[model samples]
Target: MNKKVLLVPLAAMTLSLVGCGEPDVDYTDNTRLTMRVHVDEGSEEGNGYKEIITAFNRENNGKIRVDLEFVARSGGIYETQLDNDKRKNTLPDLFTFDAPKCAYYAKNGYLYDLSSSFSTTEQDNFVALNRYQSKLFGIPIQESSAGFYYNKDMFNRAGIDVSGITVDNPWTFSQFKEACAKLKALPGLKGAVDMRLDATADETATYLLYPFIYSCGGSFVDSTGLHALNYFNSANSKKGFQFLKDLLDNGYTGTNYGAQDFFTHQVGMYLSSGWTIPELDNHVKWGQYFPDRNSWGLLPYPKADDGTAVSCNGSWSYAIGNNPRTDKSNVVTLLKYITNAKSSKVITQHTGMIPANKEAQVGYANPGSAEDVLLQQLNKTSVQRPETVGYAQFSSAFGRAIKYLKDYGVDKSVDDAAQYLEKELSRLK
Candidate 1:
């Protein structure tokens, strides 16, 4: 467990900004530190990052200028792309990535260890998923909550009242399934769909499915040991997998689970993230594409087999990439600006994501509103993905397992899939 050393003279010295309230050092040098920021440029989130950078540069007045390096997501993929760039000594000065990646990146020296970045008091103010062990790498810039979104018009027409389904009296998985059946029986109504918009993407499938498994009393990783083999195929996990298979086998979901179809009354319950709140709030329409628009209903994910309600709480995070050529001070300053409460509020507002700042959330989340529910789950019952260094591999493997179950209902092939995942993760040890 030896740490991989990057050997940059001043790279490890991050500016401690807690109560210092300033960027630690003023630039009489004002050398116009031109840092390269790598981002998934073709994406909406990437565009949001671009907007933040433009604003930051304007505010700083040429002290720091960022050249957005539009990295295509095709080459080698997450962490692999960064790893490849690192091997060539061409890594960008900064990159935005998933929060779960800090474990892998920090352990192997792909990131600067940020132990000095936040004071103990500031650490307390941070959301739960941002801190990892003793060395923090990724700062959770934006977070999200996944839940069941039902069409209120459909529910009322079906003579079903979902008005009382509060955080305290949420639906159990079985109860939710039964309700979906009743809703499905209504003329022209289809059953619920998985929250993940894309059925084939590995990351979304596994991310959306974990809450069900955790609610059923199974975990994908034993955090104490950071291992997957012994836990992923447990009995409760099988029960959870069976539930997913049932969703597919009974013809409950497919393409129409999307926003447009749900808005048009083609679907009953739409399971997805809190990002839908704004659309519902504004009564969004697709240029006469859909005939009906009902106010959407939000509820926490259905209760598990054991009645333990759970929510997936994680976000896209930013990391200081290893770059010997860039000014370490400037890079850290940008990181501070990107994650501080003010910058975080701007990013969340521009990107339509939930803020990681505790105080900032209170300003946006009205009492008992959809935003309020999302904040409550993120703070209370959220289960973050395991912080193992093998997370990228684990997510891909688990995603494949889900696809296997979808392609061919939970059969003997699933046992083989579990074995493959276990073997893949064991190599990391």
Candidate 2:
């Protein structure tokens, strides 16, 4: 037998003896809840999830105790664990999942229907965008916006003006390309942009191509089924793909670069989320490369000719495990405690992510913090990723088009890519 299993009976005896001396709060009398946090162990934001759990524990006193489980960053592994837990009927009382994955769980009946649990008053407390995006799946605990974080010093050295840029006044896609061209022409900065295109990392597809698809008014799904493949083959998608291909073809982006790698080299500009700010702050010594700390600034994603400034917003949601023994009422109570407005603010404050609740945003205003500025800018112009079932498969299909474009350039035939995407999308239905 495992040594840990052998010690369990002794551990139970010790707990009994310890219980005799302490006042036992009958949390079970009301609702004994166990919360399991599904987190990516390697991420700094993962630590923030633990901090939020710690804050929740301290505030709950003895009324509730949560158990946290850290998961590997791989989405496939995370899904596998969830599947196993569901089969064994050992689902956690509560858990966290990415927005798109949560949508799949909600659609498949694997997660509770949170739409009924939130009151009108509570629902109204969240940002309008978040309310509209995540209403049915799970409460959003944190939010981050996708955009370009550029080094102003690099821009100035390249004779590119930063004065007219604002969150509300972001450049058009054409203008963004022009600026990048100028930056690339600079003496030392060979690669002026970081458009993540690696197939191995999901961010290339999620943070890069997803927004482009949206900006072009194309989508990964239609009434019939997943349409990402068809969408990418469409004339509009082809144009968008060609634009990105042109960038890579012209040597505007770094060689062998993904999002993380590009930023690590202090590349001219990077397209990523506000959540990256904290990591950059810790990793890059600002004074070493740039003259001003304020040299790094974020802007909304550039628009297409139609003037739609598109951006992708991703967030985490609290979920209930499929465990049969968990009391429904207890689970609801636990969800309430963890996703409350104050708790949401604590998460935002610590993690540099936007609070899911609109009321929680009030805490960030007037703070003059970089995160606050990013959140404020993002709120005005952002859209959530498609929260439908089979989103993973859909996103994967979409990624293929990106890879093709990045590797072969726009000169390659779109017909093959389109046919493959359509075939893959057919499976989602």
Best by TM-score: 2
**Candidate 1 structure quality by residue, lDDT tens digits, 1-429:** 334464342344433334435223222333344333335676766676777778888888856776666665565465576777677655566776667777777777777666676667766666664445656777777888877777766777777777677666677777777777677778876555544524546577667777887788876766632566657777777777777777777777653356466656677776667766666555345324223334666778777757488788887777776655444777778877877788778778877888887766767777777777777877777888766777877777667767677666554435656677677767877
lDDT for residue 37 in candidate 1, whole number 0-100: 36
lDDT for each of the candidates? 0.68, 0.65
Give candidate 1's total backbone clashes. 0
Error of 1 at 292 (Å): 9.2
lDDT of 2 at 134: 48
In candidate 2, which residue pairs get closer than 3 Å at backbone N, Cα or C atoms, i.e. clash?
91-322, 91-323, 92-321
Ten contiguous residues minimizing lDDT sum, candidate 2: 22-31
Provide the TM-score for each candidate, comma-separated: 0.79, 0.80
